[model samples]
Target: VAKPVFMSCNDRQHSLAFGLPGMVERLNHLHIQYTDFDDLGVSHDTIRSKDIDVAMQLGKHANDQLYTFYSASPSGWLMELGWGNYEKPAAQEHYTGDIFGHAVEASGYGLDLEL
Candidate 1:
């Protein structure tokens, strides 16, 4: 079985949270071509044990400056991509959890990896 892969561009903003279908649509709209594992000789399985149903939401940390999303990696790791963080002057306060969103939906893995 092929592992779920989550891929996104570096130029993506924190506000954009496109799930698998939306991501593909956005890529097609931008005239960008992308190929997934199924396209690369991985057979499609209708019943995926790790199919992510819920899309990852844009989450703000308790500091409120950094926004990010956690997704599953093809290498069996949890990958995080973030944006809208303070660059010039670093944030003073440090927080542990998120202010809102960023909930892990995957049952066993603790991360959604469908995008």
Candidate 2:
């Protein structure tokens, strides 16, 4: 399994409600493929019922609390569908430096998660 990496806005509520869920819904409506593996035994019919494609099986990340699955987008990039309690204290900046020790390969370059 690949390590989980993603961008997060300081406002967790907006990110979770509008940012993530809205985007996922768009991808689904557009019939774009995405990665999701959080729910084990999630069948092909289930995916098609939502008008989405599954790119990875259900699994939990080792570095974070996100239980997620991966999906291949229409542009061929992977979109992660994750759910978890990842909110940190509002006073603190949520950043991790090299916690996974390597970047995830995407396209021809490495996707850096430390930014």
Candidate 3:
């Protein structure tokens, strides 16, 4: 199966909702397959717990370009952290970064959240 792309942030919040695909692609281009700097089953306060320099650098570049908080993208190794599958919660609020397919649109890449 093909791998799923996930966003990573230098900061603690993963819901920033911004430039992500480009960053991940950069990692892959460098032959770095491990996604890092993300907290899957671990505690939420461990940003410096692992080797995430590549991701950190990307975050710096991204932030420098957009001029906000850039350490928000995750490392290539982060993909291994695993953002477990969603089981369809009963009630929920639509968030900015939630995942949804744009089968209805030819251009695709629309951000959506489904409950």
User: Each candidate: what lDDT?
Assistant: 0.39, 0.39, 0.25
Task: In angstroms, give how far residue 103 of model 1 lies from its true place.
Answer: 1.2
Which scores greater on lDDT, model 2 or model 3?
2
Between prediction 1 and prediction 2, the one with superior TM-score is 1
Residue lDDT tens for model 3, 69-92:
112234432221223322322334
Error of 2 at 54 (Å): 3.8
- Where is model 1 more than 4 Å wrong at Cα? 1-56, 87-93, 110-115
Ranked by TM-score, the better of candidates 2 and 3 is 2
Clashes of 1: 1
The predictions' CA RMSDs to the true structure, in order, are 13.8, 9.5, 14.2
Question: What is candidate 1's lDDT per residue for 4-106, written digit by digit as tens?
Answer: 2334364322223222332333311111112343321121122134563322344666653455454444543333444443433234644556678877555
- For model 1 the local lDDT of residue 109 reads 39
TM-score of each model, in listed order: 0.38, 0.36, 0.20
Model 3 lDDT, full chain set: 0.25
Those runs of model 2 whose alpha carbons end farther than 4 Å from true positions after fitting are: 1-8, 11-45, 48-53, 87-115
Task: Arrange candidates, best TM-score first.
Answer: 1, 2, 3
Give the TM-score (vs. native) of candidate 1: 0.38
The TM-score between candidate 2 and the true structure equals: 0.36
Please provide, for model 2 over 1-115, each residue's C-alpha lDDT reduced to its tens digit, 9 standing for 90 to 100: 2233233455332222211221332222111122444342354346547865454444554444445555455664444555555544454445343223223322221222223
